[model samples]
Target: MTASTPGGRRVRIALQLQPQHAEYRQIRDTVLRAEDLGVDVIFNWDHFFPLHGDPDGKHFECWTMLGAWAEQTERVEIGALVTCNSYRNPELLADMARTVDHMSGGRLILGIGAGWFQKDYDQFGYEFGTPGRRIARLAADLPRIRARLAAGNPAPTRDIPILVGGGGERKTLRVVAEHADIWHSFSDLETLRRKSAILDEHGAAIGRDTARAVERSVAPHGEPEQAGEALVAAGATLLAIGVSGPDHDLTRLARWIAWRDAQG
Candidate 1:
């Protein structure tokens, strides 16, 4: 949809095509179908195992899948739902993202978050540090990530967009204020509003106007015309719907896509 916020930003639709409990072929087909349907962005989660469905079900790693998507899809922007800062060294992650950005002809968004998922950590041999420690690590890594992106042998295809996912009022939002080009969450309208306000406060504290710099993103709960409209009114320019494995039915996704077209 092309409706702009008071700040003059248009609404955008994103699909989080979760990479779990499905074969790689199914996942790849889903990405192609979503792009064909005119989704503005496509995303896959960063996980070593299923977050839902059978515990040990089929799944794919995040970055590799994103690399594949970069080669496979053409119209839509792509990225991990939120790459775990704890999984790879920050510098290496930047290099990887830059490569994918080039592969996609400059359509990559680097969605990232402080690490979670105990199983991903346990299975990969990464320490399941306390939540505070993980956030601390993310805070320390953001600067290095930016630096690496700039210093890479060949820079990213463009100034890659940074999408920071998480709604922590303290560290996470503060970091978003400082570095994020997009701020993503699964929060409902009221919480989205509250956290956005807190994000502005942090931005002000840091002497930056985050309200303009960071686009607010939320996953609407109910009908798009209702819940999604509320979110847009509450300052979310990006509406993301999450679809997972197996069938990866897009009936609901079609409805949201229709709504976006209508708004335009």
Candidate 2:
């Protein structure tokens, strides 16, 4: 179902539990704590190496941690913030998501993107293709991923929502308009409004009603509560905030949760 209700577009808060510079125990604990505090979704980035601080510091794999999150929490939706499409075969990824869907009793959101990060490719031996090539690959693979999800033996417990993360006006937004259940981005209010219009045009050309087909998502962490309020005003219903590890601070997370509760 859409995250909206009769009252208004529901304000969803997701915590991107960055899987670096911490013990697995710490990450697990943060997941539990975020759930306990009533975060709507829990996300972890997919990467082989750390995204910040000490390039060679501790890091964790994405999907494996998601499987654990599927088992650990009962209420919150768990997923990669946005999985890199180049990392795994689409069919295998579908099966993996299906397994996690069952494990979490259908509390899973499949967030995928065309892979970036050259280091992930260099160290892992994946080809760091041109941006166009990567986008083209993503455009081709999304259909296969959807088909596999449908064809799986057990199938996903529900129509697992596909959250496509990007804001490219040309190819990415077109793919999002055509297939995504959620459109996620880092754009601010005016940019979101402008690109959302492009998304609408793309949707119209494809005979899809983007307004109902996709929910807007934003990571409004720079100013937590205020940024979140502004983003919601700008048509973003899902606000994800990034929280780094080790100590796993919840100060800003708490502020957003408070703001979300206040909205209701």
Candidate 3:
């Protein structure tokens, strides 16, 4: 689905601040730089251990970092790329999202997904269910999250944009058609084109115009001009690039920001 905001174009830029092995100061500085560079959104992963290597490496909590970003950034929207459902109760997560939304002055995009990564579940003592079961839970919890957001004591200043990540053709895309404002995927160009077609089919089945229900997004990992042009042509409204580590690279991010500006 393609996202729109009163305008017809679907083009936005986001940067994922992957907290694999970085100190808090570095992560904070990277976020500031992303904001300064005029990126649209900023994100961090929601895993206890490092997803790349060294399971016992340094990492910070997702919501906490979001809170810090809320105070630190003035323009860029911030949230997890996809917060795991298994980590917290759905209602509580909604409350947290609402709080962050208000904290960021209605700039928080609540990105969530079915839980994956067994290391997180095993180490944290949360249940690690089968894929089908996990997706089922995610499907069920989305409405509850929406309900809780509405029922919260102080509702979010604005309706928080929901970003659902994953590319499961059967269940995930259908869920994206049904719930997500932005659908994020990690597929290459050919794969993204195929999956986007499938998502369009799913949206048609549900009577929701996929083109209006959600925005296509992906993580591009190369030169900004080339990657950005390719992804935009492939129906990706939001192009995300991940920056990892102790020394966060803002060079590529600046380049992408310049590209986005050029497109404008």
Q: Write the per-residue lDDT of candidate 2 for residues 1-264, one digit (tens) a residue.
A: 323333376878889999999999999999999999989999999999888998888999999999999999999999988999999999999999999999999999999999888999999999998988998999999899889999998978999999999888999999999889999986777888899889999999999999767898988846654576567766788888898867899888888887777764
TM-score of each: 0.98, 0.95, 0.95
Pairs with steric clashes in candidate 2? none
lDDT of 3 at 112: 93
lDDT of each: 0.89, 0.88, 0.87
Write the number of the candidate with greater lDDT, choosing between 1 and 2.
1
lDDT of 3 by residue, 1-264 (tens): 333234366577788998889999999888877887888899998999898767788888899999989988898888899899889999999999999998999999999989789999999999998988999899999999999999987879998999999989999888999999999987888899999999999999989988766888898867876677777777887888888888888888788777777764
> Could you tell me the lDDT of residue 41 within candidate 2?
97
Candidate 2 C-alpha error for residue 96, in Å: 0.5
TM-score-better candidate, 1 vs 3: 1
TM-score result, candidate 1: 0.98
TM-score of 2: 0.95
lDDT of 1 at 167: 88
**What would the TM-score be for candidate 3 when compared with the true structure?**
0.95
In terms of lDDT, the poorest run of 10 residues in model 3 is 1-10
By lDDT, is 2 or 3 better?
A: 2
Over the stretch 80-169, how does candidate 1's per-residue lDDT look in tens digits? Answer: 778999999999999999999999999999999997899999998999989889988988998999999999878787899999999889
